[model samples]
Target: MRIAVVGTGYVGLVTGTCFAETGNTVTCVDIDQKKVDKLKGGTITIYEPGLDHLFLRNLKESRLHFTTNLAEGIKGAQIIFLALPTPPGEDGSADLSYVLGVSGQLGKILEAYAVIVDKSTVPVGTADKVRDAIGKNAKVEFDVVSNPEFLREGVAVDDFMKPDRVVIGTSSERAKALMQQLYAPFVRQGNPIVYMDERSAELTKYAANAFLAAKITFMNEIARMCERLDADVDMVRRGIGGDERIGKRFLFPGIGYGGSCFPKDVQALFKSAEDVDYDFRILRSVMEVNQEQKTYLVPKIKRYFGDLKGKHIALWGLAFKPNTDDIREAPALYIIEALLKEGARVTAFDPEAMENVKRVVGDKITFADNQYDALNGADALVIATEWSAFRTPDFEAMEGKLNKKVIFDGRNVFEGPQMKALGYYYESIGRRPVKP
Candidate 1:
């Protein structure tokens, strides 16, 4: 199969590279000259786990290519994937300018019959809009298909190589058959390829993300209750998670759900419903709760020390979650802002995300060389993201470095009983606070 993937961002890069790995000739097109040049020079841009190996292998084998010119990239492509960005607008709706703009250009240069796949997460009916955009100037016939991606940042390569299910939305039989043939190698394990109309496929991505966001928010709510009622959230989680009806995934409570997808998709879906005069009350609540949950640890930290005017706090973890360097809506940023406003100086550490956070916050906070280095001279410790390294640490070293044996764990990485035995004042989400 010959394929062209537009907008070589996270999704586009992964999509093109993974397809090339499956023995397809893939050319990725991006408008940025520097990025295209970097990729062409054998430098992988993103820091996804296990992606660089596959990308380098494919690039080395000549199965993958990159180009700045769209026409050159899609010269003989049978399937052109529009993986452009649809960022949120001021009104909370998805801004479709990038996707539509590229579609218009594709209309003019499409030389032969092709299947244009909407690989980006767009609003419902975007396939029709894309088809119209292309139809305006296109001389040849093409089918616009909606095929939203369901890749998690850390494990995107695995998710793409072995998808649980493939949702393809196309009314045309030709486009459907082509998409099925393209995805056949992936879903060989009998994970169904769900075929539906364009609108449903577009909505499916948003629905899955929004539901996961709600589940996380609901657990955060339960954690709050457990804190007040003197009940342990871990025990409560175990009690409820045993039921088959409510599967145990996304049940762990933390500072909140934040990344590239949940916040943007929930807001967009709510706004989508609002456009038709419908009230999406649940989504609205999810938005509000998640916003508050991001900074849920701030109040606890403030109460621990009545006046944080000169306190030095050490923070561990900066990424939204582990195994990726993305920090789109990371709760750690919110916590940093709130602490700074309270006149507390912060030193933070993350294995992979410090450079990205440094770009955003600049000199507002100190970046540490390692987790223990951040703890040096700090009055208390705060765990924001649950990176694997932070799960177990040398408590003696932590006790020796910190000015005081105080910890605020947002991710509940350490057991309360252990912290109690260690004689450190520890507080975590939905669990009893350990008092030394």
Candidate 2:
């Protein structure tokens, strides 16, 4: 299939490159001339694992291309994917100007029948809005389909190459067939291609993210209760997760869920519910719980120090989670903000997220080249993100580097008893502060 992806953001670039990998001729269109130029020269801007290899290979093989011209990009293409940004408004509803603006332009430039796929995570009924925007000017027949992506940042390539299920929203048989054919190679492992109405498909993405957020928030609450009742959350999580019904993903208690998807999607869904005169009760609590969970370690740190003024703290991780540089609404950012507000100077380290944090928090805090580097001249260490490198560190080196041997393990990276044996004051969620 010949496909034109209208936008070269993370989703658009990944969609175009992945399609090109599967023997499709893909041309990605972007309004930014500089971005288009860079992509045209085989330079990928985002840092998704395994994406660069496929992007470079497809560019070399002539299957993937980039352009700034919408008309030229979509020329002779059977499918057009609108993967533009729909950032949240002040009121939390999604700002659909980008998606609708491009849709209106497609109406004017479209010359042939095509399947326009909404590949971005949009609010319910957005497909109809896109269809209406396109239908206003176009004389040709086109089918607007709601196809949301469920790709995780770190494992996007694997998720795309082997999706658990593909949801296609289209009433038109023609569009459905084309979409099915396009996704045929991906779902070869018998993972279903669920066909649903446009509204359902659009809401499915939000619902999935909201549920994941709620699940994580619920576990975080359990962890909080465990702390008060002198119970270990790890043991409680295992006790509950051992049941087949609950199972065990996202059960690990940490500094809350924060990513590009969960916070935005949950808020958008809440705003959407209000727009339609419905109050989503569970989601409201989920949002509240998550917000508190992000900064849950602040009080613990303060209690340990009695006061944080002029305290030099070592922060081990910055990214929300491991393996990606995305710091959007990351729990580490919340921790940093709280620490700075408390007059604590922080030296933070992350393998990938350091540069990203530098951009947001320019000169606000010092950065470390390595994990142990952050510990140097610091009063204690705080584990924010669970990067692989922070799992097993040289305790002697950490003890030697810090001004005093104190630790706040937010992700519960180490056993509490072990910290006591090492003769350090270590505090962790749902676990008593181990002092030896």
Candidate 3:
């Protein structure tokens, strides 16, 4: 199949590259001339694990192409994918200007029958809006399909290459057949290609992300209760996770869930419920709990020092999670802002996210070359993101750099007994503090 993907953002780029890897000719369209130029030069703009190899290979093999002109890109293509952004508005509803605007343009230039797939995480009924917008000026027939992506940031390549299930929302038999054929290679392991109505398909994407967000938020609340009741959350998490129903994934307690999807999708779903005169009370609480969880360690740090004035804190991680450089809605940003407001200076280090953080907060905080370099002259150490390197460290080196052996671990990176034996004052979520 020949496919044209509009909007070369993270989702669009990955979708186009992965499709091209499976023997489809793909041309990606983006309005950003510089980005298109970079991609044309065989440079990938996003940092996703295992994406670069496939991207370079596909580009070299002439299966993947990049262009700034949408008409040129979509010409002779059987499928057009709208992978544009649906960023949240001030009122929390999705801004559909990008998706609908392109739909209008596609109406003018479309020459033949094609399947237009909505590959972004959009609100319910967006496919209807898209179809109506395109039908206004289009003379040729085209089928608009709602096909949302469920790719996690770190493992998007794998998720695309081997999806658990492929959801295709189209009423037209012609459109459905094309989608089924396009995704047949990926679902060869017998994972289903679920066919549903457009509204249900659009809602499915939001529901999946919102449920995951709520699950993580529930565990965070459990961690809070464990702290107040003198119980260990690790043990509680392990106890509940062993049950087949509860499962182990997304059960680990941390600052909160943050990324491109969860925060935006949860808020959008809550607002969508309001549009229909329904107040989703659980989603409301999930939002509140996650906000507090992001800064849950602030009060503990303040109580320990009485005043944080002139305190130099070493922060071990900045990315929201591990293996990706994305810092959108990252809890580290919230923590850094709170610390700076209290007159505490911070030196931070993350293997990949430092450059991104530096762009957002220029000269506000010092960036370190390495994790240990961040500890030099710091009063204490704080772990925000659970990067692999922070799991085990040389205690002697950490002690030598810090002014005192005091640690505030937000991710619960260290064990309770080990910190006690090391003779350091270590505090962690839902665990007994170790005193020097």
- Candidate lDDT scores, in order, read 0.95, 0.93, 0.95
On residues 1-436, what C-alpha lDDT tens digit does candidate 1 reach at each position? Answer: 9999999999999999999999999999999999999999999999999999999999999999999999999999999999999999999999999999999999999999999999999999899999999999999999999999999989999999999999999899999989989999999889999999999999999999999999999999999999999999999898899999998889999999888889999999999999999999999999999999999998998898998988999999999999999999999999999999999999999999999999999999999999999999999999999999999999888988999999999999999899999999999999988998
* Backbone clashes in model 1, listed as residue pairs: none
Per-residue lDDT over 77-193 for candidate 2, one digit per residue giving the tens place of the 0 to 100 score: 999999999999999999999999999999999999999999999999999999999999998999999999999988999999999999998899999999989999999889999
> For residues 380-432, could you state the per-residue lDDT of candidate 3 as single tens digits?
89899998899999999888899999999989999989998998999988887
| Cα-based lDDT at residue 204, candidate 2 | 95
* Regions of candidate 1 where Cα sits further than 4 Å from its true position: none
The TM-score of candidate 3 is 0.99
TM-score of each: 0.99, 0.98, 0.99
- Backbone clashes in model 3: 0
Model 1, residue 79: C-alpha shift (Å): 0.6
For lDDT, candidate 2 versus 3, the one ahead is: 3
What local lDDT does model 3 show for residue 292?
A: 88
- Which pairs clash inside model 3? none
